[model samples]
Target: MGTKMIKSSQMNSWRRLDNSARIFPAASSVTTANVFRLSCVLREEVRPEALQQALSDVIHRFPAFNVRLRAGFFWYYFETNPNSPKVSREELYPCAPMNRRENEGFLFRVLYFGNRISLETYHALTDGTGALEFLKDLLCTYLTIVHPNIPLLSGWLDKPASPNAAVLEDGYNKIYKKARGFAPFTRRAYHLHGTPLPFTAIKVVHGVASTQKILAVAREHGVTVTAFLSSVLIWSIWQEELKGRPSWSPVAVSLPVNLRAIFDTNTALNFFECIGVGMQFNRSGITFEEILKVVSGQLAKELIKENLSQRNAYKVRLSRNPILRGFPLFIKNLVLRPSYRMGELTATTALSNLGRVELPKEYAAYAENFEFILSPTESNAIKCAVCSYGDRFTISFSSNIEQYHIQRAFFRYLTALGIELTLETNYFYDNKPVASPKGRKHKQ
Candidate 1:
C-alpha cells in the first residue's frame, strides 16, 4: 500500500530459532497448539481480494514471519517459504493447531470473517509484539487500498518500511550475560479440573469493558491494570475451583513480560519472559484486596530489570550449552517434549497483557476493536490474553474445559465492582444456547 517494497535478499537462506522459540516446536501438539491470535474488528466487512493483495505486498517486509519451520539435525530452524502466502476465510475454530503442509509451509495464517481480520501465528515465529506489528501493517495496507482518499493523521501507517538487521535479530542472544544462578524452579501449582471438550476443541469467552472505567478502578486499588486483572483471575479460580479443596498447591498465574522495552531491542523474535505470580491459599476466607496486594508486590519484585536479566541469561546459557546443542534431533525432541510438559505444571494459568494498541487517527475511525487470544494446553486448560484499543479493553479467555464457572465468576466480580462488561463467546463447548444474565449481554 505504501508503493515501496523491501524484499529479503537472503530469501532462500535458513536461520536458527531464537532462544525462547526453541521450545515451541518441541512442545507443539494437538492439545498444546502453541499458537496465538490477534484480531481487529473493522467497521465494515473485509474484502478478501484486497486483503490477499495487502498480505502479498506486506509479507515481503517481514522476513522473519515469512518463513517455514524446518527440523534440523540438532535443532529447529526456519527456512524461507517459497510459496506465496494467501488470505483465507475463517473455517476452523480460533487458534487451532497449525498444519504447515496444508498452509503452504507458512507458520502463520491471515483469516477474515465478516468485519474481523485475524492474524494467527505459531509461537515459534514471534511473540505477540511481533505479530501485532505485522497485523498493523496488514490492516493499514488493506485500509489504504479500500479507502484511498482518507488521509492518515499519523505516521503509524508508514511502518513495515524495511527489514533492518535488528528486526530479525535474536534479542535474547544479543543481550546474553553470565549469571551466577538460574531462577529457582517452581513447584507444581494447583490446577483447575474440568471435563475436556471433545476433539480438542477450544471455547473462547471475551469480556469487553471500558478501558477508562477499568483503569480508574485499578488506580483506586493502587495497582497496575495487569496486577488487578490477575488478582481477579486468581480470585475467580479460588471461588470456582480451589475454595474448599484440600490442596496446598498455590494458584499461580503466569505473566509474560515483554523484554523488548526492558532489554531495549527492536528484534521481532520471541523476546518475552514469563514470571509466575500467585498465592498459596492456606485459609478459606482470603479477600481480593489481600490477593491484590500480594500479586502487586510480587509483580513489582519480579518485573525488575536486574532480576529478569539474571533469569533470562540463565535460560540463554542453558539453550546454548555445547552438550545440549550436539544432541540429535530425535533425542532433543524426546527430551524437550517431556521437559516442556513438566514446565506447564509449574503454573496454574497464563495471563499475557499486550498493553495498549494504537492506530492512526484516520484509520481508527474504521476499526471497531481488537482482540488477543492465547491457545490452551492440556495441562493448563485455561489461559487469558488482554489488549486495549481506543476505549475498549478486552480480556479473552481460551479454554478446552466444559465448565464456564471461572469465566462467569470473573465477569461477575467485575460487574460487582461497578464496571460494565459485554460478554461474547463461541458457544462450542456445549453446542447449545447459553443464557446471559440480566444487565450483561452476549454478542454471539
Candidate 2:
C-alpha cells in the first residue's frame, strides 16, 4: 500500500524543491543518506524545555524551514508542517537517515549534547548555506531564551531581510539563462574502495587549526584558503595512492559553491552547485606547487557566473521538461538514482567550506566553535567540511570506510607544514592514532 500523504490541511501552501534539491528524494537510501549538519557549541549546557520554546519561536520566522516532504505522481514537494519538531538529546551518530516516519514527517532534526546544539537536515530541505542560516537563528533564539540578560546586537536574533517571499524563492528560476552552453560533463575519477565500517557507522576526525596561520600560508602561496587546502587534500590522496591506480585515474576534490553570492537573492533554499577539481598524474608523483596551481585555476574558472548559471540552467531545464515532468514518481526515481550515482563518479571526495561565522560580540563569550559536517554518501566514501569561528578554523573529515589512510595523511601533511593541530572524535576509542600509508601510525 502506498503511504498516506502527510500535509497540513489547514495550511494551503506548498513549494517545489529547488533545482539542486530535485534529486535528493529519488537518490536517498539507507546507505547513501543525503544530509548535512550545522552545529553550534555554546559555553552553557543546553536546557531542553528552553531550547524547544526557542525553536518554536524561530520556526515562525523561517517558514521555508518548517516543511514536510511529500510524494506526488510527478515529483516530490514540500508541504507545511504544523507538527512541532521533536527535540531530543544527541544520540546515535550524525547524518543518520531521516525518512518521514523517523523525523515525525519533518525533513530536519534537532539534537543537543551537553553544550552543543546540532541541526541536521536532509539536503532536499536546503543546502549548507540555508541550513547554516537556520542554525544561526536557532542559536540566537536559544541564547536569548536561556540568558535573558545578555544583550543581543541590533537585529541579531531578528528575522531575515524584507520580502519573506525571497526567503523561499526558487533562485534557479530567477537566474537561469537558456544558453546553448551545456552543463559540464563528468568523467570517471578515482574512487576510494575498501572494507566497510561495521554497523553502517560513520567515523569523523576533526583537525582544528589557526585560521590566521592557514590564511598566511595560503597568502604566501598566492592562493585562497580553499585552493590551499584542496591542494593539500589532492596531494595527500595522491600520496596514499602511491601509483597503485591506472595512469588515467585522477584525484578530484568536489566543492560546493554558494550561489547566494553570485545570484542576487537571499533565499534560504538550495542555492548552490558542486564543481570538481581534478588532476591526473604519471608514474612520477605531482608536486604541491603544481596541484595548487591547477586547483587555483580550476576554482577561478568554475566559480564564475557564466559557468554556474549555465550549469544550473541545465538542471532547471531537465526538471521542467514537459515529458519528464509528466513521468510518474516511480519512473522518475529509477531514472534519477542511476544518473545521480553516475555523476558521483566525477569526484573521488568532496570538500565544502562554509567560510567564516562571526557571532555578535555579546554572544562571543557564550559560544565556543561551529562545525559543518557532510554526511558520507554511498559512492563517495569520504568527504570533508571546513568552517571558521573567531580565530579557530576546523576541518572535519567524515568517512564510512574502515581504512582512514587518506584522512591521516591529509592531517599529517598539514602538521608537517608547521600548522599546530588538535584532533577530536565522536567515538571514544577513535582518539587513538590511525595507521599511516607506510604502516607506521601516530597520533595527531
Q: Which candidate number maximizes TM-score? A: 1
Top lDDT prediction, candidate number: 1
Give the TM-score of each candidate. 0.94, 0.92
lDDT tens per residue, model 2, 1-444 = 542332334234887888888899999997888988888888788899999998888876676777788898888998888788867887667788778876668888888877788898999988988888888878878888889998766666654423256677789899978875566657888888877776546878788899999898899999999999999988888878654333577888899889898878888888888988977876574678988998999999998888887888788888888999898999999999999999888888999999999777777778888988888887789999999998889999888877778888988988988899887765434566543211223232
Report the backbone clash tally of model 2.
0
Q: Which residue runs of candidate 2 sit more than 4 Å off their true CA positions?
A: 1-12, 152-154, 158-163, 243-246, 428-444
Cα lDDT tens digits for candidate 1, 385-420: 999998999999989888888888999999999999
Model 1 worst lDDT run, 10 consecutive residues: 435-444
Assess the local accuracy of residue 193 in candidate 2 as a C-alpha lDDT between 0 and 100. Answer: 85
Candidate 1, residue 72: the lDDT equals 81
